[model samples]
Target: MRPVLLLLLGAHLAYAGKHSLKYIFTAVSGDIDFPEFTSVGLLDDGQFDYFDSNTMKAVPKTEWIRQNEGADYWTRATQNLIGTHQTFKVSIQTVKERFNHSTGVHTWQLMYGCELDDDGSTRGYHQYGYDGSDFVSLDKSSLTWTAANPQAVITKHKWEATTYAVKEKAYLENTCIEWLKKYVDYGKDTLERKVSPQVSLLQKSSSSPVTCHATGFYPSGVKISWQKNRHDHDEDVDLGETLLNEDGTFQKTSTLGVRPEEWKNNQFSCVVEHQGKTIRKTADDIITNFESVPIGIIVGAVAAVILLLVIGVAGYLVYQRKKGFKPVSGSDDGSNSSAHT
Candidate 1:
């Protein structure tokens, strides 16, 4: 019992502990625009013109008039500034509250557009108002933006910003958990039922090398290496381009070639690295060695051998006992024979 317990303890210790980081990063971008409002006016005549109801006059296109109106209205109201381009950036930061348990925080930033006027200084108040400042925070829980300073208002702006957390531990933990869930849900069928690594050995008579090809999906980056007798061998490795699937997943292939002798005697391994751990599959002539014999086969073979040996030994013992038995069946019969002699 003690020995068995000790063995189990040793086995547990020998099993590699999970290795993982605290965070994962994913980048995404999208187009954002404020809806056009009705207060802004539209351009009607050909000569860079706009109708201003407040002044009760037809005003020529000017910066002051455009500043009060939105960019979409101003651009459409005048032919001079029509077809202008505006670019903005959006940044999101995921903050975690619990190291590996609870959800945390998220921050957002917006940088409005600004440009230099004819006076060699930044102008265009409509575009310049919100420049170089944090505008809002996107609450992850509510999925809505919270204005940092609600009272601060700007007319025309293009915002670019990023939000991140100080304690990255929570972020990493959540990322790892999410990745694990995704891997299990979508990747389990392919990953759990392990496939033997497809291996092909090519030989070259000249100094030129041969290439071996292998294709597989490994959510965790896999290490494809050439080996000789389970030892790492130096060889040229070429990783081909990975193709993304329609489901937003990716698949890649790796190719490597070694000398003919290396392939003949040594074992080659494709090790999949994931979650700070490695799982390996080796091929000798492209065939997989079973990690363990099937339970039914193993039990049947052992039982048959044991039963046959038992029967054979029992029959041999019976034969030996019969052969050795000598009957002193009659002292009387022996005495009669001696008298007759």
Candidate 2:
């Protein structure tokens, strides 16, 4: 029941801290486009290191890690990940057999992390999931395993019998927190930096929903809301997931669905809040794309024009050959095909 509660209430298991270090490993079986295994290391929810079955090498995702860590660090990390990869392969099979799953897509996930609060409070967790449901989790206080279902009992007993939980607890409390502190020191400038998002109001047409997109912000936390006639409007609004950008920043979008007549008669605004800064965009800021030609159509038109020009030139050559007129041969003209000659 504890594990089941953890499964249902994820992201609320512990209070969010000022910083966190997490390692997420996923192993998959059956046919899928994704890699068979992947391991990601995150510092404060931003990826700092990554490894996969395809790469078979642990590599830094952030420049700070790249600059701070050397080849020896990567080599050790890679070796550890290789062992983890093999273990995950076997673990997935073991879990599959336990669940009586013979085929199809099955995933065995392990998420373990330590959080450090600004007030010096700390929390650590190690959890496992099978097929997107909780299998078991470590109860650090009692040094026991909490199984979500009967199928996980065997694993729980087997793991408890050995010194696995002891080793894991040690690592989570000591080594994990140590590495987290070192990483925070390494990327303190980037991690603690607060960059305001570039907000934009967009719509494809009058009938389409108005979207407030905020991009290029650090720390990832943001709030987007809609206001009608200067009052908070929550109806017919959709909030999208915050996503990481390639440049290590974050982006988020919130869409408001309202009729054109309603928006025209009433004042509508999108308000974005990030890092203690509030930005509000009114209807005047909405950028409509319906009047603009699509890039595909523009490219096709350009290609069509170029193709017609080429065809016309080729046809003229054919017509000229058909007539009595002929150009002199290259050999007769005393010119070689080689430009240098």
Candidate 3:
């Protein structure tokens, strides 16, 4: 009979262990917030029990039970939930409830308490951390969410900078090309052309002596002189000083002061001596039928005055003939006209 009683006691203890292992709090419908705690019944050894929602486990507080009120029932329930070795297994019902309702909630609280780090240190909260509060609501049907990383943002900025640099370089290159094209076009098309030199002469109507100024830019060397009927007289030819410009071009001018008679029936010319060839251009050649004083008009006016005087004398002689008048030498009487008739 004692052996049978011992067998029954062992069987009862084994059944009790199995029932204790299976006993776990199942979370039903409610808003499950993380890192919260609740009090459960005490264990038979009189210890306090606290349920943690973050770890989904129960923990026994033995020292707490000895120091606080309701130690007997609180300690027993805590021991039953935490087990003998102060370790608890997470309930599947709690895990399922947390997983199903974790669509937009913290899911790290579902981990068993034993799985937590023993150092009691938690990683700081960040956008990608497990305890991060910066989570977007997950679409339950699509099971998708959006996130951003700082590395990707930095890469995008670098790409934009590179593109701007390339564009600036291209703009500078195009501007240089345009400038070169303009320079080449100007150099090829713009140059001076040769033209015949122009000449002009001026004189005063009064007795003032004539003045002559000859000015021109001749690429070829030139000679300018005043001549009387193509004869060179002893006169001073005022040759102006030559000037050299920055562009390697030359200019020359000459002047002469002469009496008015010097231009009488005379031609003044500017002769260009270039490359063993002499080209003579005169001011007379430019002015058609140019003469000093118009001698023909003067002679014609004198002849007209003389002819008119002669005609008047002839008419007085004819009138004397018609009146039958005779003239006597040194006679003052009118009777001499009849004696001559």
Write candidate 2's Cα lDDT for 123-142 as tens digits: 77777767766678778778
Query: Ten consecutive residues with minimal summed lDDT in candidate 1?
Result: 1-10
Candidate 1 local lDDT, 1-341, one digit each (tens):
00000000111211122211110011112232221110111110001222221232323333333344455543443322111111111222111111131332221112111121122222110101021222332232332334434322211011212222111122222322333232223322433333322233332332334333333323424455555566765567765433222221233444455555655566666543433555455543332222343443334335433422221222212221322110000000000001000
Candidate 2, after superposition: displacement of residue 234 in Å? 1.7
All candidates: CA RMSD (Å): 38.7, 21.1, 62.8
**Which candidate number would show the highest lDDT if scored against the true structure?**
2
Error of 1 at 262 (Å): 12
Q: Is candidate 1 or candidate 3 better by lDDT?
A: 3
What overall lDDT goes with each candidate model? 0.26, 0.66, 0.27
The TM-score measured for candidate 3 stands at: 0.22
A best-first ranking of the candidates according to their lDDT comes to 2, 3, 1
Maximum-TM-score candidate: 2
Root-mean-square deviation of Cα positions for candidate 2 versus the true structure, in angstroms: 21.1
Report RMSD for candidate 3: 62.8
Kindly report which residue pairs in candidate 1 clash with one another. Answer: 22-172, 23-172, 91-161, 93-163, 95-105, 111-159, 111-160, 229-266
